[model samples]
Target chain A: MVEITVKVVGQRTRRLKVDPGTTIAELLRRVGQNRETVVVRLNGRIVAEEERLKEGDLIEVIPVVTGG
Target chain B: MLRCSFCGRRAVYHRRYAGVFLCDRCLIKSVERRFRRAINENKLILPGERVAVAVSGGKDSVACMHLLHDYCRGKRCELVAITIDEGIKGYRDESLPIARENAEMLGVEHHVVSFREAFGATLDEMVKVAAQRSTGLNPCTYCGVLRRSLLNQAARELGADRLATGHNLDDETQAIMLNYIRADLSRLYRLGPGYSPRQGFVPRIKPLREIPEKEVALFALLKGIKVHLAVCPYASGIHMEVRDFLNSLESNHPNSKFMILRMFDEIKPHLEAAVPGFEARGCESCGEPTSSTLCKSCELLQGLGLMRRRKNLIFVEPS
Candidate 1:
């Protein structure tokens, strides 16, 4: 298992343990977010949803939608 | 790891609708190409004209300013920026600096008009009064009408040929759907890329209308641009609900937003014939262009007791 930290900018931060070879898409799904409303970054670099996670990987999910 | 479909570099974004992955460079290029295409295809701008961009310091507006800064150079167009301060204490105050910074960075002239100065009340104050008076209108209705009026007035005073706003594909689609739901054909007809010019009203143009909200935010991030990412406190309404519904639909069916936009475009021309002629006249209260005697802004202000009729003229009461 790999432990990862997901920080949702302007929201909350969560650390979770997941299986190896988990994709960012899977992580977001676990956290109740989807790709349509956010952009994901892994280790300070923007990444695609298909990018797999590594041990101690730090992911940032920034919600890009705003009203008004 | 996946590679960019075009350049074979490590991909950064998966454009699901297009079935392709893009690296940072390719993504930037793709965004720029589409922006130019939208402008050219719609003839949104003309050479040697001045465009006043409405920069609210958000990702979409900031990205629009930056892209227009570059695009305007080749076209020999002058770019100016206008930021409307709606007097939301924590929100608009925080964004004003970011908007100023980007305008200064691009050496574009920037102007700010506040709700307090124009309407004699801050949005917060107006909301309080509205609640106290039991006005059954949402805050967005007031903000939308007043802010749009301020943008037009500022742009016209600045001698801008066009007032540009940062409305992305998501916003456009949501508006389209909302108007459809409300059966407001007049507003639906006015949702095209360029609005027809009216006396006392500078025509508005939306250059970022084709790009999705996510891509605009991502473009700003990849280019190291700083943007204020705060959402408004008074953002809940039917529009927000529509936004969520559309987002979910787009998530399940890739290109759903694009499909809706395409369908709107296909049927938009017919809306003109159905809606009939619109005759714009100066509002009796504010002298702004409107289809009726009083502009929507003046009506909202009057409803909130922020303005009163005095000696055959409407004067804003000091709140």
Candidate 2:
């Protein structure tokens, strides 16, 4: 099992245990986020949703919607 | 690991619609290039024009401002920023500083017009009073009409040749689909690259119309452009549903947003021919251009008991 941290910027952060080599897409689905609505960063670098997350990966999800 | 299509750097974005994997540098470059292409293709701007950009301090708007700033650097076009504060507590107030910061960072002259200043009531107060009076109107109805009016007025007062907005492909597609769903031909005609010039109205141009919303967000993120990334608390309704539907549709059918935009463009000329342009007259109450007797903002304010019209004079009651 791989343990990783997920942070939805401006919302919440949580540590989760998942199977080894979890993709960002799977993490987003687990966290109840739509791929269309947010951008993902793994370990401080922007990454594709299909990019696999490794152990100790710090994934940050930044929502794209904004109010003016 | 997927390699960037343009350069073999680490891929950061996988554009499913185009089947391209792009690194941060290539993504930023392509987004900027697409922005410039939209401007050039549509003739959205010209040399030596003073442009007022509607910056909400959001990803799309701030990215629009940033790209426009870079595009206008050598073209002798002046870029200014205008932010309309709808006075939504915790929403507008939070974004106000981000907008200011972005404009200051770009050294662009920024102007903030607020609902309180223009209509004598903040949106929060208006929403409260509206609820108490059973107005049955959503907060978006009030905010949209008022904000558009204020932005235009501010742009015209700034002597801007054109007012630029950061409406990406997703926004363009949603608006097109929504208008089609409502069969609102008049509004459908208005959803082009540039709005038709009218008296007392600054021509509005959208340069980011070709880029996708995700690309705009990614561009802003990669470029280190600061933006307020909070969704509006009152962003529910049919529009949200349409946005979600479109997003889902696009997810399943990649390039659907671009297809919708392209389809609209193809039919826009026909739509324009069928539906004649609106004849706007100065509002009797405030002299702002309106199709009806009173402008929408004035009508809303009057309906909410915040403004009263008497003998060609309108008096706003301070909230």
Candidate 3:
């Protein structure tokens, strides 16, 4: 299992334990979030939800947003 | 590891739509290139022309302001930031400072226009009044009309040669889709990177038209620009649904967003001659160009009873 700190910018930060390699999509599903409405960032870099996260990874899920 | 399409560096963004992976450097270059190309191809701006950049302090508009400022430095054009405070209470109040900060940082002259000054009411008040009357229009629709009016009036008063907005490919595509669904051919005809010149109206331009929303945000991030991150409190309804739908479609189909935009561009030229010429006369109440005797802003205000609804549309011929 891998321990990673998850932080959603402008929202919340947490630490979680996950399998050796878990995709961001699975993490979002576990958190009960709609993948289409959130941007997954791993270690300060935007990544696809399909990105496989690693131990000690810092993850952020930002809501899908743009200005009018 | 995926490599940048142009550079040998490790890729940061894999644009499935284009089948290209870009690193931070290459990505920035690509975005900037698109920005310049949109302007050059569409002639959105001419040398020495002053552009009033509408900034909402969001990543999209702020990125636009910064990009245009940099682009204008060499092109000998001038940029001024125009931000409209829709008076959404918690919303506009929070975003204003960020707009000011970015304008100050860019050394561009900033103009903050308010609904209170223009229409004697904040959007929050407008919403309350509208709800009491049970108006058919949504808050976003009212706010959009008012904001567009104020932006244009401010830009025109400032003697700007053009008014530039930060609309991206996603925004454009969503709008196109909406207009298409509504069968609003005239509105669809007007959707493009640059709006042609019309008397009594400052031409509007969108230099970021070719870029995607996510990339605009990433460009802002990579440029170390600070922008307001909060979404508007009233951003619910059809627009949001359309945005979500298009986003999901893009995710599944990759280049679907670009395909929509490209398709619109192809259709726009054919629409030019077919779309009937529109002529605007001085609005009876606001004196702005309107096919109706009263401008949309004035008509809307009249609905709020903020202004007396003059029976002027009867005399005004359709444009």
List residue ranges in candidate 3 displaced over 4 A.
A10-19, A25-39, A45-51, B1-3, B308-319
Best by lDDT: 1
Predicted candidate 1 versus true structure: per-residue lDDT over B255-300, tens digit per residue: 9999999999999877777986758998888777888899898999
- The sequence of per-residue lDDT tens digits that candidate 3 reaches over residues B94-116 is 88999999999889989888787
Worst 10 residues of 3 chain A by lDDT: A32-41
DockQ score for model 2: 0.56
Scanning candidate 1 chain B in windows of ten residues, the lowest lDDT window is: B308-317
Model 1 residue pairs with clashes:
none
| Model 1 stretches astray by more than 4 angstroms | B308-319
How would the docking of model 1 be graded? medium
Q: What is the DockQ of candidate 3?
A: 0.37
Which rank order by DockQ, best down to worst?
1, 2, 3
Question: Residues B255-319, candidate 2, lDDT per residue (tens digit)?
Answer: 88888888888887777568866688999888888878998888999889875222221223478
Model 2: CAPRI class: medium
Clashing pairs in 2: none
lDDT of 1 by residue, A1-68 (tens): 99999999876788999999999988888998868888998998899998999899999998888853
lDDT of 1 at B193: 85
lDDT of 2 by residue, A1-68 (tens): 89999999887789999998778888888998878778988898888888987789899998885422
User: What lDDT score belongs to each candidate, Candidate 1 first?
Assistant: 0.89, 0.86, 0.82
